[model samples]
Target: MGLFPRYKRAARVAGAAILAALLAGCSGLGSKAPPPTYELMAVQSFPRGVGPIRGQLIVAEPSALALLDSDRIMVRLANGQTEQLANAQWEDRLPKLLQARIIQSFENGRRLRAVGKPGDRLVADYQLLIDVRAFQISADSNTADIEIAAKIVGDRSGRIRAARVFKVSVQTDSTEGPAAVAALNDAFNRAVVQLVLWTTRVI
Candidate 1:
Protein backbone atom coordinates (compact mmCIF):
# COMPACT_ATOMS: atom_id res chain seq x y z
CA MET A 1 0.00 0.00 0.00
CA GLY A 2 1.64 3.27 -1.06
CA LEU A 3 0.68 6.83 -0.14
CA PHE A 4 -0.75 7.29 -3.70
CA PRO A 5 -2.93 4.17 -3.94
CA ARG A 6 -5.44 5.69 -6.42
CA TYR A 7 -2.64 6.79 -8.77
CA LYS A 8 -1.22 3.27 -8.77
CA ARG A 9 -4.64 1.82 -9.69
CA ALA A 10 -5.02 4.27 -12.58
CA ALA A 11 -1.58 3.39 -13.93
CA ARG A 12 -2.34 -0.32 -13.77
CA VAL A 13 -5.64 0.16 -15.68
CA ALA A 14 -3.95 2.20 -18.38
CA GLY A 15 -1.22 -0.39 -18.79
CA ALA A 16 -3.79 -3.17 -19.11
CA ALA A 17 -5.67 -1.23 -21.78
CA ILE A 18 -2.48 -0.73 -23.80
CA LEU A 19 -1.73 -4.42 -23.63
CA ALA A 20 -5.21 -5.34 -24.77
CA ALA A 21 -5.04 -2.93 -27.70
CA LEU A 22 -1.68 -4.33 -28.78
CA LEU A 23 -3.03 -7.88 -28.75
CA ALA A 24 -6.29 -6.97 -30.56
CA GLY A 25 -4.85 -4.48 -33.05
CA CYS A 26 -6.83 -1.23 -33.25
CA SER A 27 -10.14 -2.75 -32.18
CA GLY A 28 -9.71 -4.07 -28.66
CA LEU A 29 -12.14 -5.98 -26.43
CA GLY A 30 -11.75 -3.29 -23.80
CA SER A 31 -14.33 -0.72 -22.75
CA LYS A 32 -14.15 1.07 -26.07
CA ALA A 33 -16.84 0.20 -28.64
CA PRO A 34 -16.22 -2.05 -31.63
CA PRO A 35 -14.98 -0.51 -34.85
CA PRO A 36 -17.55 0.25 -37.56
CA THR A 37 -17.31 -1.33 -41.01
CA TYR A 38 -17.65 0.32 -44.46
CA GLU A 39 -18.00 -0.84 -48.03
CA LEU A 40 -17.63 0.63 -51.55
CA MET A 41 -20.49 0.61 -54.05
CA ALA A 42 -20.46 0.39 -57.83
CA VAL A 43 -21.58 3.29 -59.96
CA GLN A 44 -25.14 2.62 -61.05
CA SER A 45 -25.22 4.42 -64.41
CA PHE A 46 -22.63 4.16 -67.16
CA PRO A 47 -22.48 5.69 -70.62
CA ARG A 48 -24.75 3.72 -72.87
CA GLY A 49 -24.28 3.54 -76.69
CA VAL A 50 -20.50 3.39 -76.35
CA GLY A 51 -19.91 2.67 -80.05
CA PRO A 52 -20.99 -1.02 -79.98
CA ILE A 53 -17.90 -2.69 -78.50
CA ARG A 54 -18.77 -6.32 -77.82
CA GLY A 55 -16.70 -8.92 -75.96
CA GLN A 56 -16.70 -11.21 -72.97
CA LEU A 57 -14.61 -9.58 -70.29
CA ILE A 58 -13.27 -11.08 -67.09
CA VAL A 59 -12.14 -8.90 -64.22
CA ALA A 60 -9.27 -10.25 -62.19
CA GLU A 61 -8.82 -9.71 -58.50
CA PRO A 62 -6.81 -6.53 -58.11
CA SER A 63 -3.26 -6.79 -56.79
CA ALA A 64 -2.17 -4.53 -53.94
CA LEU A 65 0.86 -4.17 -51.72
CA ALA A 66 0.84 -5.16 -48.07
CA LEU A 67 -0.22 -1.75 -46.83
CA LEU A 68 -3.29 -1.43 -49.06
CA ASP A 69 -4.23 -5.12 -49.18
CA SER A 70 -5.97 -5.55 -45.85
CA ASP A 71 -9.55 -4.95 -44.74
CA ARG A 72 -8.35 -2.17 -42.44
CA ILE A 73 -9.14 1.37 -43.54
CA MET A 74 -5.74 2.94 -44.23
CA VAL A 75 -4.61 6.39 -43.11
CA ARG A 76 -1.37 8.36 -43.17
CA LEU A 77 -0.64 10.58 -40.21
CA ALA A 78 0.44 14.20 -40.49
CA ASN A 79 4.05 13.26 -39.81
CA GLY A 80 3.95 10.88 -42.81
CA GLN A 81 3.48 7.93 -40.50
CA THR A 82 1.02 5.23 -41.60
CA GLU A 83 -1.80 3.80 -39.51
CA GLN A 84 -5.36 2.46 -39.85
CA LEU A 85 -8.60 4.22 -39.11
CA ALA A 86 -9.02 3.31 -35.46
CA ASN A 87 -12.81 3.36 -35.59
CA ALA A 88 -13.56 1.87 -38.99
CA GLN A 89 -12.70 -0.97 -41.37
CA TRP A 90 -13.74 -2.20 -44.78
CA GLU A 91 -16.55 -4.75 -44.84
CA ASP A 92 -14.36 -7.08 -46.88
CA ARG A 93 -10.76 -7.30 -48.08
CA LEU A 94 -9.90 -4.26 -50.14
CA PRO A 95 -9.02 -6.20 -53.27
CA LYS A 96 -12.09 -8.39 -53.11
CA LEU A 97 -14.36 -5.42 -52.62
CA LEU A 98 -12.77 -3.62 -55.53
CA GLN A 99 -13.07 -6.62 -57.83
CA ALA A 100 -16.73 -7.18 -57.02
CA ARG A 101 -17.70 -3.56 -57.51
CA ILE A 102 -15.76 -3.34 -60.76
CA ILE A 103 -17.53 -6.34 -62.16
CA GLN A 104 -20.82 -4.76 -61.21
CA SER A 105 -19.79 -1.54 -62.90
CA PHE A 106 -19.01 -3.33 -66.16
CA GLU A 107 -22.37 -4.99 -66.02
CA ASN A 108 -23.92 -1.60 -65.39
CA GLY A 109 -22.35 -0.35 -68.61
CA ARG A 110 -24.58 -2.89 -70.42
CA ARG A 111 -22.33 -2.89 -73.50
CA LEU A 112 -20.23 -5.94 -72.82
CA ARG A 113 -21.42 -9.24 -74.24
CA ALA A 114 -20.56 -10.69 -70.84
CA VAL A 115 -18.57 -9.98 -67.70
CA GLY A 116 -17.25 -12.75 -65.50
CA LYS A 117 -14.63 -13.42 -62.89
CA PRO A 118 -11.73 -15.83 -63.40
CA GLY A 119 -13.64 -18.47 -61.43
CA ASP A 120 -16.63 -18.24 -63.74
CA ARG A 121 -15.13 -20.63 -66.30
CA LEU A 122 -16.18 -18.57 -69.27
CA VAL A 123 -14.29 -18.08 -72.53
CA ALA A 124 -13.64 -14.37 -72.50
CA ASP A 125 -12.46 -12.24 -75.40
CA TYR A 126 -10.58 -9.77 -73.25
CA GLN A 127 -9.38 -9.60 -69.68
CA LEU A 128 -9.24 -6.49 -67.56
CA LEU A 129 -6.34 -6.59 -65.09
CA ILE A 130 -6.17 -4.12 -62.25
CA ASP A 131 -3.49 -3.21 -59.73
CA VAL A 132 -3.96 -1.13 -56.63
CA ARG A 133 -1.18 1.40 -56.37
CA ALA A 134 -2.31 3.55 -53.43
CA PHE A 135 -5.51 3.93 -51.41
CA GLN A 136 -5.28 5.80 -48.16
CA ILE A 137 -6.60 8.84 -46.34
CA SER A 138 -4.25 11.42 -44.83
CA ALA A 139 -4.86 12.19 -41.22
CA ASP A 140 -3.15 15.57 -41.57
CA SER A 141 -5.98 16.55 -43.90
CA ASN A 142 -9.31 14.80 -44.45
CA THR A 143 -8.30 14.00 -48.02
CA ALA A 144 -8.32 10.48 -49.43
CA ASP A 145 -5.74 9.43 -52.01
CA ILE A 146 -6.41 6.71 -54.59
CA GLU A 147 -4.30 5.42 -57.45
CA ILE A 148 -5.00 2.44 -59.70
CA ALA A 149 -3.29 0.88 -62.70
CA ALA A 150 -5.09 -1.18 -65.32
CA LYS A 151 -4.22 -3.35 -68.30
CA ILE A 152 -6.39 -4.76 -71.07
CA VAL A 153 -5.18 -7.94 -72.73
CA GLY A 154 -6.62 -10.14 -75.45
CA ASP A 155 -7.50 -13.45 -73.86
CA ARG A 156 -6.94 -15.52 -77.02
CA SER A 157 -3.88 -13.79 -78.44
CA GLY A 158 -2.31 -13.05 -75.06
CA ARG A 159 -1.30 -9.62 -76.33
CA ILE A 160 -1.63 -6.48 -74.30
CA ARG A 161 -3.82 -3.87 -75.90
CA ALA A 162 -3.80 -0.90 -73.53
CA ALA A 163 -2.64 0.15 -70.09
CA ARG A 164 -3.21 3.22 -67.94
CA VAL A 165 -3.00 4.58 -64.42
CA PHE A 166 -5.58 6.58 -62.49
CA LYS A 167 -5.25 8.93 -59.53
CA VAL A 168 -7.93 10.74 -57.54
CA SER A 169 -8.07 12.92 -54.43
CA VAL A 170 -11.15 13.69 -52.38
CA GLN A 171 -11.62 15.92 -49.36
CA THR A 172 -13.79 14.08 -46.81
CA ASP A 173 -13.82 16.83 -44.14
CA SER A 174 -15.27 14.52 -41.51
CA THR A 175 -12.30 12.48 -40.33
CA GLU A 176 -13.79 9.51 -38.47
CA GLY A 177 -16.30 6.85 -39.47
CA PRO A 178 -18.99 9.31 -40.45
CA ALA A 179 -17.63 10.88 -43.65
CA ALA A 180 -14.30 9.16 -44.28
CA VAL A 181 -15.92 6.13 -45.87
CA ALA A 182 -18.28 8.27 -47.95
CA ALA A 183 -15.25 10.11 -49.28
CA LEU A 184 -13.41 6.90 -50.12
CA ASN A 185 -16.46 5.45 -51.86
CA ASP A 186 -16.85 8.61 -53.89
CA ALA A 187 -13.24 8.49 -54.99
CA PHE A 188 -13.49 4.82 -55.90
CA ASN A 189 -16.63 5.37 -57.98
CA ARG A 190 -14.99 8.15 -59.95
CA ALA A 191 -11.75 6.28 -60.54
CA VAL A 192 -13.50 3.07 -61.59
CA VAL A 193 -15.65 5.08 -63.98
CA GLN A 194 -12.54 6.19 -65.79
CA LEU A 195 -11.11 2.68 -65.80
CA VAL A 196 -14.33 1.40 -67.33
CA LEU A 197 -14.47 4.16 -69.93
CA TRP A 198 -10.87 3.55 -70.94
CA THR A 199 -11.39 -0.18 -71.25
CA THR A 200 -14.42 0.41 -73.44
CA ARG A 201 -12.41 2.44 -75.91
CA VAL A 202 -9.43 0.06 -75.94
CA ILE A 203 -11.30 -3.23 -76.16
Candidate 2:
Protein backbone atom coordinates (compact mmCIF):
# COMPACT_ATOMS: atom_id res chain seq x y z
CA MET A 1 0.00 0.00 0.00
CA GLY A 2 2.84 2.40 0.80
CA LEU A 3 4.58 1.75 -2.54
CA PHE A 4 1.29 2.21 -4.42
CA PRO A 5 0.61 5.60 -2.77
CA ARG A 6 4.14 6.78 -3.64
CA TYR A 7 3.71 5.68 -7.24
CA LYS A 8 0.33 7.49 -7.58
CA ARG A 9 1.77 10.70 -6.12
CA ALA A 10 4.72 10.56 -8.53
CA ALA A 11 2.32 10.16 -11.52
CA ARG A 12 0.20 13.07 -10.35
CA VAL A 13 3.25 15.27 -10.03
CA ALA A 14 4.44 14.28 -13.52
CA GLY A 15 1.05 15.10 -15.04
CA ALA A 16 0.96 18.51 -13.33
CA ALA A 17 4.46 19.35 -14.61
CA ILE A 18 3.51 18.37 -18.16
CA LEU A 19 0.39 20.53 -18.06
CA ALA A 20 2.35 23.49 -16.75
CA ALA A 21 4.93 23.14 -19.55
CA LEU A 22 2.17 22.97 -22.21
CA LEU A 23 0.42 26.06 -20.87
CA ALA A 24 3.67 27.98 -20.76
CA GLY A 25 4.45 27.05 -24.36
CA CYS A 26 1.01 28.17 -25.46
CA SER A 27 1.34 31.55 -23.73
CA GLY A 28 4.64 32.37 -25.41
CA LEU A 29 3.30 31.28 -28.81
CA GLY A 30 0.11 33.30 -28.41
CA SER A 31 1.89 36.49 -27.36
CA LYS A 32 3.94 36.78 -30.56
CA ALA A 33 0.97 36.11 -32.89
CA PRO A 34 -0.30 38.91 -35.12
CA PRO A 35 -3.89 40.12 -35.45
CA PRO A 36 -6.12 39.45 -38.43
CA THR A 37 -5.53 41.67 -41.45
CA TYR A 38 -6.33 41.48 -45.16
CA GLU A 39 -5.45 43.03 -48.50
CA LEU A 40 -8.15 45.68 -48.98
CA MET A 41 -10.28 45.14 -52.09
CA ALA A 42 -13.41 46.69 -53.66
CA VAL A 43 -16.84 45.56 -54.95
CA GLN A 44 -19.52 47.15 -57.25
CA SER A 45 -23.28 46.74 -57.72
CA PHE A 46 -26.41 48.59 -58.98
CA PRO A 47 -29.68 49.36 -57.20
CA ARG A 48 -33.18 50.98 -57.74
CA GLY A 49 -33.57 50.31 -61.48
CA VAL A 50 -36.95 49.08 -62.68
CA GLY A 51 -35.91 47.81 -66.09
CA PRO A 52 -33.08 47.88 -68.58
CA ILE A 53 -32.36 51.07 -70.57
CA ARG A 54 -31.87 51.65 -74.29
CA GLY A 55 -28.09 52.10 -73.93
CA GLN A 56 -25.54 50.48 -71.61
CA LEU A 57 -23.27 52.49 -69.34
CA ILE A 58 -19.63 51.56 -69.11
CA VAL A 59 -17.39 52.04 -66.03
CA ALA A 60 -13.60 52.16 -66.33
CA GLU A 61 -11.81 50.69 -63.34
CA PRO A 62 -8.34 51.71 -62.20
CA SER A 63 -5.70 49.13 -61.33
CA ALA A 64 -3.85 50.58 -58.35
CA LEU A 65 -4.46 52.93 -55.42
CA ALA A 66 -2.24 55.98 -55.80
CA LEU A 67 -0.22 56.18 -52.58
CA LEU A 68 0.55 59.80 -51.77
CA ASP A 69 4.25 60.21 -51.13
CA SER A 70 3.84 63.62 -49.51
CA ASP A 71 0.97 62.77 -47.17
CA ARG A 72 2.63 60.33 -44.77
CA ILE A 73 1.93 60.80 -41.06
CA MET A 74 2.74 59.25 -37.69
CA VAL A 75 0.03 56.81 -36.58
CA ARG A 76 -0.46 55.68 -32.97
CA LEU A 77 0.79 52.14 -32.42
CA ALA A 78 -0.45 49.49 -30.02
CA ASN A 79 2.46 50.41 -27.75
CA GLY A 80 0.80 53.86 -27.30
CA GLN A 81 3.55 55.82 -29.05
CA THR A 82 3.45 56.40 -32.85
CA GLU A 83 4.65 54.86 -36.11
CA GLN A 84 4.55 55.93 -39.75
CA LEU A 85 2.70 53.67 -42.16
CA ALA A 86 1.90 53.99 -45.88
CA ASN A 87 -0.66 56.53 -46.91
CA ALA A 88 -3.22 57.10 -49.73
CA GLN A 89 -3.47 53.74 -51.44
CA TRP A 90 -7.12 53.15 -50.60
CA GLU A 91 -8.19 53.12 -54.26
CA ASP A 92 -5.26 51.08 -55.51
CA ARG A 93 -6.29 47.97 -57.45
CA LEU A 94 -9.76 48.64 -56.10
CA PRO A 95 -11.65 49.67 -59.24
CA LYS A 96 -14.41 47.20 -58.46
CA LEU A 97 -15.24 49.10 -55.28
CA LEU A 98 -15.55 52.38 -57.17
CA GLN A 99 -17.50 50.82 -60.03
CA ALA A 100 -19.91 49.20 -57.60
CA ARG A 101 -20.55 52.46 -55.76
CA ILE A 102 -21.20 54.36 -59.01
CA ILE A 103 -23.50 51.66 -60.34
CA GLN A 104 -25.52 51.64 -57.14
CA SER A 105 -25.84 55.42 -57.26
CA PHE A 106 -27.09 55.44 -60.84
CA GLU A 107 -29.40 52.54 -60.19
CA ASN A 108 -30.89 54.36 -57.22
CA GLY A 109 -31.57 57.36 -59.49
CA ARG A 110 -33.55 55.18 -61.95
CA ARG A 111 -32.69 57.75 -64.64
CA LEU A 112 -30.28 55.62 -66.58
CA ARG A 113 -32.24 52.94 -68.42
CA ALA A 114 -29.31 50.57 -68.46
CA VAL A 115 -25.84 50.29 -66.88
CA GLY A 116 -22.95 48.07 -67.92
CA LYS A 117 -19.27 47.85 -68.63
CA PRO A 118 -17.56 49.17 -71.82
CA GLY A 119 -17.81 45.83 -73.70
CA ASP A 120 -21.37 45.09 -72.67
CA ARG A 121 -23.82 44.47 -75.55
CA LEU A 122 -26.62 46.77 -74.33
CA VAL A 123 -26.81 50.00 -76.34
CA ALA A 124 -26.21 52.96 -74.03
CA ASP A 125 -27.46 56.55 -74.41
CA TYR A 126 -25.28 58.11 -71.69
CA GLN A 127 -21.91 57.07 -70.29
CA LEU A 128 -20.57 58.05 -66.90
CA LEU A 129 -16.89 59.00 -66.65
CA ILE A 130 -15.43 58.78 -63.14
CA ASP A 131 -12.03 59.85 -61.85
CA VAL A 132 -11.05 58.95 -58.29
CA ARG A 133 -9.21 62.06 -57.19
CA ALA A 134 -8.39 61.63 -53.49
CA PHE A 135 -9.41 58.39 -51.82
CA GLN A 136 -7.10 58.06 -48.83
CA ILE A 137 -6.71 58.20 -45.06
CA SER A 138 -5.74 61.63 -43.72
CA ALA A 139 -3.93 61.82 -40.41
CA ASP A 140 -4.90 65.44 -40.27
CA SER A 141 -8.55 64.39 -40.28
CA ASN A 142 -7.91 61.20 -38.30
CA THR A 143 -10.10 59.43 -40.84
CA ALA A 144 -10.33 58.43 -44.48
CA ASP A 145 -11.85 60.58 -47.22
CA ILE A 146 -13.07 59.79 -50.74
CA GLU A 147 -13.24 62.24 -53.62
CA ILE A 148 -14.40 61.34 -57.11
CA ALA A 149 -14.79 63.53 -60.18
CA ALA A 150 -17.70 62.29 -62.27
CA LYS A 151 -19.37 63.29 -65.54
CA ILE A 152 -22.39 62.15 -67.49
CA VAL A 153 -22.08 62.23 -71.28
CA GLY A 154 -24.62 61.44 -73.97
CA ASP A 155 -23.41 58.50 -76.02
CA ARG A 156 -25.15 59.32 -79.29
CA SER A 157 -25.08 63.12 -79.03
CA GLY A 158 -21.58 63.39 -77.42
CA ARG A 159 -22.73 66.12 -75.03
CA ILE A 160 -21.86 66.56 -71.40
CA ARG A 161 -25.07 66.27 -69.45
CA ALA A 162 -23.64 66.76 -65.95
CA ALA A 163 -20.26 66.98 -64.22
CA ARG A 164 -19.23 67.32 -60.62
CA VAL A 165 -16.57 66.35 -58.12
CA PHE A 166 -17.84 64.59 -54.97
CA LYS A 167 -15.77 64.62 -51.79
CA VAL A 168 -16.45 63.20 -48.32
CA SER A 169 -14.43 62.59 -45.14
CA VAL A 170 -15.26 59.78 -42.68
CA GLN A 171 -13.83 59.15 -39.22
CA THR A 172 -12.93 55.57 -38.21
CA ASP A 173 -12.78 54.13 -34.71
CA SER A 174 -10.17 51.49 -35.52
CA THR A 175 -6.58 52.08 -36.58
CA GLU A 176 -6.40 49.01 -38.81
CA GLY A 177 -6.78 48.53 -42.56
CA PRO A 178 -10.35 47.28 -42.21
CA ALA A 179 -11.27 50.34 -40.18
CA ALA A 180 -9.83 52.62 -42.81
CA VAL A 181 -11.80 50.75 -45.49
CA ALA A 182 -14.98 51.02 -43.48
CA ALA A 183 -14.51 54.78 -43.29
CA LEU A 184 -14.05 54.99 -47.07
CA ASN A 185 -17.14 52.82 -47.54
CA ASP A 186 -19.23 55.10 -45.37
CA ALA A 187 -18.11 58.13 -47.34
CA PHE A 188 -18.79 56.27 -50.58
CA ASN A 189 -22.33 55.39 -49.51
CA ARG A 190 -23.13 59.04 -48.80
CA ALA A 191 -21.58 60.17 -52.07
CA VAL A 192 -23.55 57.59 -54.04
CA VAL A 193 -26.80 58.59 -52.38
CA GLN A 194 -26.29 62.23 -53.26
CA LEU A 195 -25.07 61.45 -56.76
CA VAL A 196 -28.11 59.28 -57.43
CA LEU A 197 -30.46 62.05 -56.38
CA TRP A 198 -28.59 64.53 -58.53
CA THR A 199 -28.66 62.22 -61.54
CA THR A 200 -32.38 61.59 -61.14
CA ARG A 201 -33.12 65.30 -61.27
CA VAL A 202 -30.91 66.04 -64.29
CA ILE A 203 -31.16 62.88 -66.46
Candidate 3:
Protein backbone atom coordinates (compact mmCIF):
# COMPACT_ATOMS: atom_id res chain seq x y z
CA MET A 1 0.00 0.00 0.00
CA GLY A 2 2.91 2.39 0.78
CA LEU A 3 4.56 1.64 -2.60
CA PHE A 4 1.24 2.21 -4.35
CA PRO A 5 0.96 5.75 -3.01
CA ARG A 6 4.57 6.53 -4.06
CA TYR A 7 3.84 5.16 -7.52
CA LYS A 8 0.70 7.35 -7.80
CA ARG A 9 2.73 10.47 -6.83
CA ALA A 10 5.45 9.60 -9.36
CA ALA A 11 2.86 9.14 -12.10
CA ARG A 12 1.29 12.51 -11.30
CA VAL A 13 4.69 14.23 -11.45
CA ALA A 14 5.47 12.67 -14.83
CA GLY A 15 2.09 13.73 -16.20
CA ALA A 16 2.64 17.31 -15.06
CA ALA A 17 6.10 17.42 -16.70
CA ILE A 18 4.69 16.14 -19.94
CA LEU A 19 1.90 18.75 -19.88
CA ALA A 20 4.38 21.55 -19.21
CA ALA A 21 6.62 20.49 -22.09
CA LEU A 22 3.62 20.34 -24.42
CA LEU A 23 2.46 23.80 -23.38
CA ALA A 24 5.94 25.26 -23.97
CA GLY A 25 6.08 23.69 -27.41
CA CYS A 26 2.67 25.08 -28.25
CA SER A 27 3.71 28.57 -27.14
CA GLY A 28 6.85 28.45 -29.26
CA LEU A 29 4.85 27.38 -32.28
CA GLY A 30 2.28 30.16 -31.84
CA SER A 31 4.83 32.97 -31.69
CA LYS A 32 6.16 34.31 -34.97
CA ALA A 33 9.22 36.48 -35.59
CA PRO A 34 8.58 39.97 -36.83
CA PRO A 35 9.36 41.01 -40.35
CA PRO A 36 12.35 43.04 -41.46
CA THR A 37 12.37 46.83 -41.78
CA TYR A 38 13.32 48.77 -44.89
CA GLU A 39 14.14 52.35 -45.67
CA LEU A 40 13.73 54.59 -48.71
CA MET A 41 16.89 55.31 -50.64
CA ALA A 42 17.89 58.93 -51.14
CA VAL A 43 19.00 60.37 -54.41
CA GLN A 44 22.42 61.62 -53.40
CA SER A 45 23.37 63.62 -56.49
CA PHE A 46 21.30 64.80 -59.40
CA PRO A 47 22.61 65.69 -62.83
CA ARG A 48 24.42 69.04 -62.94
CA GLY A 49 22.20 71.82 -64.19
CA VAL A 50 22.68 75.18 -65.93
CA GLY A 51 22.69 77.22 -62.74
CA PRO A 52 21.29 77.33 -59.24
CA ILE A 53 17.88 78.84 -58.70
CA ARG A 54 18.17 82.18 -56.96
CA GLY A 55 17.04 82.63 -53.33
CA GLN A 56 15.96 80.08 -50.78
CA LEU A 57 13.41 77.40 -51.58
CA ILE A 58 11.41 75.69 -48.88
CA VAL A 59 10.20 72.12 -49.46
CA ALA A 60 7.13 71.45 -47.39
CA GLU A 61 6.20 68.04 -46.08
CA PRO A 62 4.17 66.16 -48.64
CA SER A 63 0.49 65.63 -47.89
CA ALA A 64 -0.86 62.09 -48.20
CA LEU A 65 -3.94 60.01 -47.57
CA ALA A 66 -4.23 58.31 -44.22
CA LEU A 67 -3.31 54.97 -45.73
CA LEU A 68 -0.15 56.27 -47.32
CA ASP A 69 0.88 58.27 -44.29
CA SER A 70 1.94 55.32 -42.16
CA ASP A 71 5.30 53.57 -41.91
CA ARG A 72 3.82 50.26 -42.99
CA ILE A 73 4.48 49.25 -46.57
CA MET A 74 1.19 49.19 -48.45
CA VAL A 75 -0.02 46.85 -51.15
CA ARG A 76 -2.97 47.28 -53.47
CA LEU A 77 -4.84 44.05 -53.97
CA ALA A 78 -6.62 43.01 -57.11
CA ASN A 79 -9.89 43.30 -55.30
CA GLY A 80 -9.18 47.02 -54.83
CA GLN A 81 -8.53 46.77 -51.14
CA THR A 82 -5.24 48.03 -49.74
CA GLU A 83 -3.20 45.90 -47.36
CA GLN A 84 0.17 46.09 -45.67
CA LEU A 85 3.08 43.78 -46.23
CA ALA A 86 3.45 41.06 -43.66
CA ASN A 87 7.02 41.39 -42.41
CA ALA A 88 8.27 44.73 -43.66
CA GLN A 89 7.90 48.35 -42.63
CA TRP A 90 9.22 51.72 -43.67
CA GLU A 91 11.92 53.47 -41.65
CA ASP A 92 9.61 56.36 -40.86
CA ARG A 93 6.25 57.83 -41.62
CA LEU A 94 5.71 57.99 -45.36
CA PRO A 95 5.25 61.74 -45.66
CA LYS A 96 8.22 62.65 -43.46
CA LEU A 97 10.37 60.10 -45.23
CA LEU A 98 9.47 61.46 -48.64
CA GLN A 99 10.00 65.03 -47.50
CA ALA A 100 13.50 64.24 -46.37
CA ARG A 101 14.23 62.45 -49.62
CA ILE A 102 12.95 65.36 -51.65
CA ILE A 103 15.10 67.76 -49.68
CA GLN A 104 18.06 65.50 -50.22
CA SER A 105 17.28 65.30 -53.92
CA PHE A 106 17.32 69.06 -54.19
CA GLU A 107 20.56 69.22 -52.26
CA ASN A 108 22.06 66.64 -54.58
CA GLY A 109 21.20 68.79 -57.56
CA ARG A 110 23.21 71.63 -56.08
CA ARG A 111 21.22 73.86 -58.39
CA LEU A 112 19.38 75.69 -55.65
CA ARG A 113 21.09 78.69 -54.08
CA ALA A 114 19.56 77.76 -50.74
CA VAL A 115 17.19 74.97 -49.84
CA GLY A 116 15.39 74.70 -46.54
CA LYS A 117 12.23 73.81 -44.63
CA PRO A 118 9.51 76.12 -43.30
CA GLY A 119 11.22 76.93 -39.98
CA ASP A 120 14.63 77.66 -41.46
CA ARG A 121 13.99 81.45 -41.26
CA LEU A 122 15.57 81.89 -44.66
CA VAL A 123 14.00 84.48 -46.90
CA ALA A 124 12.32 82.25 -49.42
CA ASP A 125 11.82 82.97 -53.10
CA TYR A 126 9.54 79.99 -53.61
CA GLN A 127 7.97 77.13 -51.75
CA LEU A 128 7.53 73.62 -53.13
CA LEU A 129 4.15 72.16 -52.26
CA ILE A 130 3.83 68.42 -52.68
CA ASP A 131 0.78 66.18 -52.57
CA VAL A 132 1.32 62.47 -52.64
CA ARG A 133 -1.49 60.84 -54.58
CA ALA A 134 -0.23 57.29 -54.54
CA PHE A 135 2.70 55.31 -53.21
CA GLN A 136 2.16 51.60 -52.99
CA ILE A 137 2.99 48.17 -54.31
CA SER A 138 0.53 46.18 -56.40
CA ALA A 139 0.11 42.67 -55.08
CA ASP A 140 -1.49 41.33 -58.23
CA SER A 141 1.16 42.52 -60.66
CA ASN A 142 4.02 42.89 -58.22
CA THR A 143 4.81 46.47 -59.20
CA ALA A 144 5.38 49.77 -57.52
CA ASP A 145 3.65 53.02 -58.45
CA ILE A 146 4.40 56.51 -57.18
CA GLU A 147 2.47 59.63 -58.02
CA ILE A 148 3.04 63.13 -56.71
CA ALA A 149 1.61 66.52 -57.59
CA ALA A 150 4.04 69.38 -57.21
CA LYS A 151 3.38 73.09 -57.14
CA ILE A 152 5.77 75.96 -56.90
CA VAL A 153 4.39 79.00 -55.12
CA GLY A 154 5.91 82.43 -54.73
CA ASP A 155 6.45 82.76 -51.01
CA ARG A 156 5.39 86.38 -50.70
CA SER A 157 2.56 86.31 -53.19
CA GLY A 158 1.27 82.87 -52.15
CA ARG A 159 0.40 82.35 -55.77
CA ILE A 160 1.06 79.11 -57.52
CA ARG A 161 3.70 79.70 -60.16
CA ALA A 162 3.92 76.23 -61.70
CA ALA A 163 2.13 72.97 -61.12
CA ARG A 164 2.66 69.49 -62.47
CA VAL A 165 1.94 65.89 -61.64
CA PHE A 166 4.67 63.27 -61.63
CA LYS A 167 4.03 59.55 -61.86
CA VAL A 168 6.19 56.47 -62.34
CA SER A 169 5.74 52.72 -62.22
CA VAL A 170 8.36 50.03 -61.91
CA GLN A 171 7.73 46.31 -62.09
CA THR A 172 9.11 44.11 -59.39
CA ASP A 173 11.06 40.97 -60.22
CA SER A 174 9.40 39.03 -57.42
CA THR A 175 6.59 39.26 -54.90
CA GLU A 176 8.91 39.43 -51.91
CA GLY A 177 9.24 42.49 -49.72
CA PRO A 178 12.77 43.25 -50.83
CA ALA A 179 11.79 43.10 -54.48
CA ALA A 180 8.81 45.35 -53.91
CA VAL A 181 10.96 47.83 -52.02
CA ALA A 182 13.55 47.83 -54.78
CA ALA A 183 10.88 48.55 -57.33
CA LEU A 184 9.43 51.29 -55.16
CA ASN A 185 12.84 52.91 -54.83
CA ASP A 186 13.35 52.83 -58.57
CA ALA A 187 9.98 54.41 -59.22
CA PHE A 188 10.46 57.04 -56.53
CA ASN A 189 13.90 57.94 -57.87
CA ARG A 190 12.54 58.40 -61.35
CA ALA A 191 9.83 60.68 -60.06
CA VAL A 192 12.28 62.71 -58.01
CA VAL A 193 14.60 63.11 -60.95
CA GLN A 194 11.82 64.44 -63.10
CA LEU A 195 10.49 66.66 -60.32
CA VAL A 196 13.88 68.26 -59.69
CA LEU A 197 14.43 68.87 -63.36
CA TRP A 198 11.00 70.42 -63.78
CA THR A 199 11.29 72.57 -60.66
CA THR A 200 14.64 73.92 -61.69
CA ARG A 201 13.29 74.81 -65.09
CA VAL A 202 10.17 76.53 -63.81
CA ILE A 203 11.44 78.12 -60.58
TM-score (C-alpha, index-matched) for candidate 3: 0.82
lDDT of 2 by residue, 1-203 (tens): 67999999999999999999999999998884433332332223435555443345655553333442222322444444444444433332356656655675565455566776677776776777777666565655577666777787888798999898888878888545567657766777777776665655555
Runs of candidate 2 with Cα error greater than 4 angstroms are: 1-56, 62-92, 108-111
Give TM-scores for every candidate, taking all chains together and pairing residue i with residue i. Answer: 0.81, 0.58, 0.82
Global lDDT of model 1? 0.87
lDDT of 3 by residue, 135-188 (tens): 999878778999999999999999999999999989898656788899999999
Give lDDT: candidate 2, residue 38: 29
RMSD score of candidate 3 (Å): 5.1
For candidate 2, which ten residues in a row score worst on lDDT? 65-74
Best-to-worst TM-score order: 3, 1, 2
Candidate 3 residue spans exceeding 4 A from truth: 1-34
Evaluated against the true structure, the overall lDDT of model 2 is 0.61
- Residue 133 error, candidate 1, Å: 0.9
- Residue 10 of model 2, lDDT score: 97
Q: Candidate 1's residue-wise lDDT over 1-203, tens digit each?
A: 57599998999999999998798874544557668878789989976664775888999999999888889988888898888887899988999999999999988987778998997988899998899988888878788889999999999898999999999999998767868888888899899889888887777
Error of 1 at 102 (Å): 0.4
The C-alpha RMSD in Å for every predicted model, in order, reads 9.4, 9.1, 5.1
